[model samples]
Target: MPPHSLLELHDITREYSLGKSRVNALRGVDLSVSAGEFTVVTGPSGSGKTTLLNIIGCLDRATSGSYRLDGEEIGDRDFDALAEVRNRKVGFIFQSFNLIPVLDVAENIELPCRLREEGGRNQRALRARVEALADAVGLRPYLHHKPDELSGGQRQRVAIARALITEPRLVLADEPTANLDSATSQHILDLMLRLNREQGVTFLFSTHDPRVVAHAWRVLHIQDGKLLSGEYPGVSRRASGAS
Candidate 1:
């Protein structure tokens, strides 16, 4: 593990057992992500990109090797224990946006905090924070509007706000802009980059989108369940005029 790495995976590997077969999703992959760094993991479909991310985010346990998140070794924890750890330590943004259809924008952003300990008891404070986040995401006008009332870009903004509701140390995104059009995707990417730079929030996302990779300060490539060096580096706003 590198010094000051908020997330570290050492020789991590995962295997899924079919009834009569075994599938190796990750093969001895080691990675270290420091705090406040915007990193992207890139790979083709079924190349273990999501699998590696799942392991780091504590959504999936590694079959072999050591994994440390926020300085604690977590590879050996059971499912329930891992869930608790993940909820407290990491925030996730998915490809689908995953907003509640019935809940308004503010309510959706505050959902994670509402699931936390004493969240209900601190309702007023949570509401205030949610409103602030809504404003920050430029969704203040739609706070009372349900998911059906918003466009794709607005919905993704809501997702980003919701992911940061808890003020977690790390945020993991799985192709968060995959469902949006190029223009909307660029808008969403700009929002994430602004948040990362302004708030110093660490972001690690997996994507096949070169546009997303173009903004990443560090890029890690995976192929055939193994980490491989690629020509994805030297990419940034300064390098490619991508924001």
Candidate 2:
């Protein structure tokens, strides 16, 4: 693992048994992510991109090899330990918004804080936080609206706010732009980039879109269940500028 890496995976491998056969999702994959970096992972379908993200986010354990978060070994931790780590240190954004249809925007954003029991944030504070996040994502006008009442883009903005509600050290987004149109996708990407710069929040995402990759400070390319490139250095200007 590199020095100052907040997340590290060393020779990690994950496999699932399908009847008599074994399907390897990841093989000897190594990666390190540092603080304040926006890293994008891209590959073809069935290339283990989502699997890798799940492992890194502590949502699933690896079959073999060492995985570390903030220098703490996570592969060997129990389920409860992993859940705690995820709740306190990691936030997740998915392509499908995943907002509760019955919950209003502010309620959805406050769900993480409620789960963590980090009280002392009275309704006023919570509302302020939600308002600030909504303003940032342009969702302030829909605070009382439920998920079913909002458009796909609005729901996604609510999801982003919910992900950041916990102020986690790391945010993992899987195909966040997949549900939006081109214009909305660009807007959301810009929001994420600005948040990364302003809040110094680390971000890792799995995406196939070149537009998404263009916003990243680093890019990892995976092939055949292995990390094929993006081991050293960060994003290149030429690559960033490429269409």
lDDT of 2 by residue, 152-178 (tens): 888888988999988888999999999
**Scored by Cα lDDT, where does model 1 land?**
0.87
**What does the lDDT read for residue 44 in candidate 1?**
86
RMSD of each: 2.8, 3.2
- Where model 1 places Cα greater than 4 Å from the true spot, the runs are 1-3, 230-243
Cα lDDT tens digits, model 1, 1-243, are 432889888999899998989999999998888887788998889999999888888889999999998989999999999888887889999999999998999888988877766467877888889888888889988989999999998998999999999888899999999999999999889889988878888999999888988778888889889987644453445244442
| TM-score of every candidate | 0.93, 0.92
- Model 2 misplaced stretches (Cα beyond 4 Å): 1-3, 119-121, 231-243
Clash number by candidate, in order: 0, 0
Query: What TM-score, to 2 decimals, does candidate 2 have?
Result: 0.92
